[model samples]
Target: MKLYIKYMVSLRCKLLVRQELEKLGLHHISIELGMVEIKEEITEEQKQGLKSNLAASGLELLDDKKSILVDKIKSVIIEMIHYAEEIPKGNYSDYISEKLGYNYIYLSNLFSEVKGITIQHFIIKHKIEKAKELILYDELNLTEISYRLHYSSVAHLSNQFKKITGHSPSFYKKLGKKRKDTLENL
Candidate 1:
């Protein structure tokens, strides 16, 4: 059976899930972002145990189809933003659509209804968060950061950064590691 997981967006979460499965003596075929497939069918008691285990680790097993789809969407976006070395070419809408096998309009509508934000807004929020990370790392100048994030220009990046963060990237860097929101929060 394939289990859909909520908030399984990071490598640490994957490890935790794997550990939980092993603790339960379940043989998992694979565990990817937001999902786990196991070779054997799980009993109700085992499912409940697994769910509680995951809950203790700040994850949830999704049952509803709509909720599962939403989790999948979040997984894809998180992977693209936090893990990918570079943002993939082409528009995110197209990428998401192709990745999920849903039409762009349907994905946008579902995401907006479920997330209470447009998909574009979600992408922008993640991009700004990534920009902050790069700023804190101090390895890349603002210009390079802009280019790395696929912003058209440094000014555009600065404007968006200021708009979202109420401070320029330079000022934020100087402030020295102000708390950043977790990826799950974003």
Candidate 2:
């Protein structure tokens, strides 16, 4: 059975979730961001125990189809930003649809309904977050980062970053305060 989880974003979170399942004597076949597939269906008592334990850690087990779809979309974006070495420049709609094996319209509508935000907005938000990460690492200049993320130009990236974050990328880097969002929200 595939179980959707909230806030299972980082590698550390994946390990933590794995540890929690082991503690509860649950055998999981695989674990990934925002989800896990267990070897067997969970009993009601086991579900409740998991719900309580995960809630204490600020994670929730998701059950509904729409919510699960939303998590799947978020998971794809997170993986792309955090792990993918390169993303091609093109219509991301087709790319995401192909990657997730769902029609773009279905994914977009479901995501907006569950998240109260458009998928494009979510992507932009995460792009800004990735920009922050790159700038923090000081591995690339603003222009290089802009090209890496396939932004039209540095000006465009700066404009979008300022609109979402109320600060320019350069200013954000100067302040050096780490801004972040929860994985579910991001």
Candidate 3:
């Protein structure tokens, strides 16, 4: 059976889920952002146990379909932003639509209604977060990071970064403080 988990947006969460499954004697197929697949269906007591364990760690075992869909959207956006090496080609809406098998307009509207933020804004936030990571790593210069992330130009990237962060990318890089995304935001 597949399990949809809220707040399973981080690697640590995945590890926790994996450990829980092992403790429960469950066989897992795969564990990805906001999702888990196990070979066997869980019993009621097992469900309760898992739910309690997950809840204690600020995660939820989602049962409702709509909630699952919302978490799926969150997971995909997180994957695209945090794991994808380069920005996808074509329009983001089209890419997300194709990825989720939902119409872009409907998904965008639902996301905004449920999350209280526009999909565009979410994408921008993720982009900025990714930019921060790139800058901190110092593996690539601003121009290269911009190009890799499909930003129009270094100036545009810096402008967006500064707009969101209230500090220039160079300043942030020099400060070397951690830039992190909230779990809900990711």
Off by over 4 Å in 2: 177-186
lDDT string for model 2 (1-186, tens) is: 989997778888888888889988999999999999999889998898888888888888988888888888898888877778986577778878988899999999889988899999998998899998999888899999999999999999999999999999999987764343333356
Quote the lDDT for 181 in model 1. Answer: 40
How big is the positional error of residue 131 in model 3, measured in Å on the Cα after superposition? 0.8
lDDT of 1: 0.90
Candidate 1 local lDDT, residue 105: 94
Residues 56-172 of candidate 3: C-alpha lDDT, one tens digit per residue: 999999998878888888888889888876668789999889999999899988888888998888888988998888888889999998988888999999999999999999999
For model 3, give the RMSD to the true fold: 5.5
lDDT of each: 0.90, 0.87, 0.89
Clashing pairs in 1: none
Candidate 1: list runs displaced more than 4 Å: 177-186
lDDT of model 1 at position 99 = 91
Model 3 stretches astray by more than 4 angstroms: 177-186
TM-score of each: 0.91, 0.90, 0.90
